[model samples]
Target: MTLSAAGLGSTTQPLSTVYDLAMLDLDGVVYVGRDAVPGAVKALTEARTNGMRLSYVTNNAARTPHEVAEHLRELAMPEVDDGDVVTSAQAVAHLVADAVPTGSPVLLVGGDGLRGPLEERGLRCVTSLADEPVAVVQGFHPDVGWRQLSEASFAIQAGLPWFASNTDLTIPTARGIAPGNGSLVQTIRNATGASPVVAGKPQKALFDETMERVGGRHPLVVGDRLDTDIDGAINAGTDSLAVLTGVSTLQEIIERAPGQRPTFVSADLAGLNESHLEVELDGDRARCGAATAVVRETVVSLETGEPAGTEALRAVVGLAWSVRDRSDASLTVDGTLGA
Candidate 1:
């Protein structure tokens, strides 16, 4: 469904009470690298106490659910258990099993993350096409090298179906961003001129898996990235909240593309228990709480009675996005959004 001129949405009640479950993106939403995002643990605990079930979702296919849960526990999130985590590996495994017969040998190009789930589906994992494998599954693993990719290419050339856990081009690390599964998938795609069926974020497979694991009457997708987490929610036909603790910036969200906008915006996880201010649309102005934003000609201006905060930013996004949608007006927002 298309968002109205006002954009995604607004809510009077706290999100924790309104939604039964929260499908959260792990890397950016919960923790950065090794530490929890500021206020994340406390906010999540409060959300759970308020009756919201938290489900950790990720496109990273290298680690198993238990490993991810352990990492969360290390970050002081004791509430996260193996059952509370959903991985793209699990999604791709089901996708592969549905196509191929159960107990069929599938060529595996990933690590234990892919092997464990495929085994659970009764599919045998093989290293080579010589095993007479019926299909191939690829995911991100540090050990995946030329040999694995060559075997996958051979299988695909022999008409074996191919599936991928995710197509994310980059994975963030302590040093910097590194090549992710998508970059490796691109190599195979370029060589064989064929693409694998992807089953991750920005796709419906991962979301479906999350919903199946955690029952949600009205699930709210909580995340930090606009491209994956927020867009995934749009694809799944669910509402999403974008927090500022990770990769996305206020300006980036203000100029969000179609099908990539979020229903709510907050400084951090604290938003789960707080009411989201509504962006009220006027003739040419959008107002939220005490802040108003208007676009005249090629300039977007922000006017606020109080100091600007997350709610004020939402007003600016509503006005800026609406103006950009209607015309080629340039957005002049240099001094509007504070640091």
Candidate 2:
């Protein structure tokens, strides 16, 4: 929604009281491949030290929770327990085990890590559908082949459930980029024209699991991707912080509708802790930083494609105050209106 002065003062609020739990996206938010983002570790540690509960949620299907934890340790991040990490591999396994019969045979087209969760769920993993499998489970398979896709389609066509771990088409890899599970899932779907049940971000199940793991009065989701992380937060009925370290850019944020807009946005995790202090509103954007009072002004048309007016000016200022309240920032308005 377009920012108006009337709504500004009412919306701003201090951020400290706005969120209790922070749901962090691992890949883009914490690091890109093996290199950790600057200040990621410090930001997260500070959040925890400030009494905020933290949990790392990832869409990486290639790594298991234990493996992910070790990777984080190598990056010098705070220690995370096994239960604190969630992955698409784990999500798919949970879905399959809960829905399908125990000990059911399923054709797995993914890596050893993806298969680990399935095995733990008591599902027997097979290489092909030759055994008349009960289902076809797909995740990120770096060595996937056309033969595997054909076999998965065949299994699904035979009345077997087609389950996909996630729909992330492109996964960031050390070697630039690699095809993710979505690419394979689409290939199988194109062959059989079959739609499998997806179990990952942008889905309610993943969000539910995350909230359950990091319980809080209010949880804030932080991520760089719009489709998965942002959508997930919206689905979970929680606020979100869209960082520019990953998929979405500043232009995309400017063009987004209010429903898709994050509660806060920043260059990286570095400025997140300052979100509760002060209120900032410039045109369509709004942000908060820790401070006692904030005031902002911008010139804009009273009507769409029309000239500016005193009414339009007052509207935006009021809107900034409203935003301050939402961010839990304290506010005070003065009569000195700038032209």
Candidate 3:
């Protein structure tokens, strides 16, 4: 696959045939909340059958890996175990373990997700600063509140080593979008005027951790979010696929700078088994398969053909980015996505 700005790659073989391992992100990529996305089980099962090692790597530090595996199994996914899953909790724990004394007491601001990994790494978990903790580590949990943040604030204010699983400002819930661990971390940061060493997405640590554990020669980072999942892959210099089953939209992705874009795009996990069509660019136009996109002044139009939706989007995105790279003119591709 050619790696370049606005260079959506094409392959004669399926992605499962190209990559040895798949580093998956939870939430929008696999399951949202307590349920699995439609056809997720089937798609993943097929990818596994195609000899691609599937590793669930997530920034969500709320649940233990076992809990995540259990949830996946309950949703009728393949026989997934805790070892097959990696969390930001584990990533942060590794960072903390490398820096601090073994068996040291750490002020844990989250739940057992943080506690389990810390203890596994020979670190101790404590709730209060009165415990004489050596460091403060935080993650996200629904139950985290003022008291925990207060303890973290106290510890951080006093110059204790602080580490955080991630800095995602918001997380999606069954109800709606809500504050994530990063949001709470911001509260403590504001109070203490300190920043914790982050180990999650957009940081290279978590992906590196996944690589160490999963042991893949060629890995594909797959997720729905641009900021964390796709951008994290870019940060790690890894190939990524942005699926539309979750938060980000086609329109939003096409407008980003080249370095921030994913290597591939698909409507869902089902795209894993399909041959990708490359977006070919002409003067002021882009084409993918039967779909064509042309720039008419400041507005970009995706002219529909046999296979429109995503193909047209690929063309439009290529054209939009090509235009962006040449001039500072803004593109308007608002209503062309559904075409």
Please tell me which predicted candidate would have the highest TM-score against the true structure.
3
Ten consecutive residues with minimal summed lDDT in candidate 3?
A: 305-314
- Ordering by TM-score: 3, 1, 2
Q: Write the per-residue lDDT of candidate 1 for residues 81-185, one digit (tens) a residue.
A: 798999999999999989988999999999998899999999999999999999989999989999999989989999988999999888776666788899999
**Per-residue accuracy of model 2 over 58-166 as CA lDDT, tens digit each:** 7777777888888888887775777777787787888899988999988998887788999999999997778867888888767778888888888888888888878
Error of 1 at 5 (Å): 5.0
Model 3 lDDT tens row, 1-339: 664325666675789889998999988889989989888999999998999999999899999999999998899877687788999999999999999999999999999888999999999999988999999999999899999999899888888999999998888777767888889999998998999999999798999999998789999999988989999999998999888877877777867876688888877887788767777888788887788888998888866643335566567777788888889677887573632
Would you list the C-alpha lDDT of every candidate in the order shown? 0.84, 0.67, 0.85
List TM-scores for all candidates, in order.
Answer: 0.91, 0.77, 0.95
Clashes of 1: 0
Lowest lDDT sum, 10 consecutive residues, model 1, at: 1-10
How far in Å is the alpha carbon of 162 misplaced in model 1? 0.5
The lDDT leader among the candidates is 3
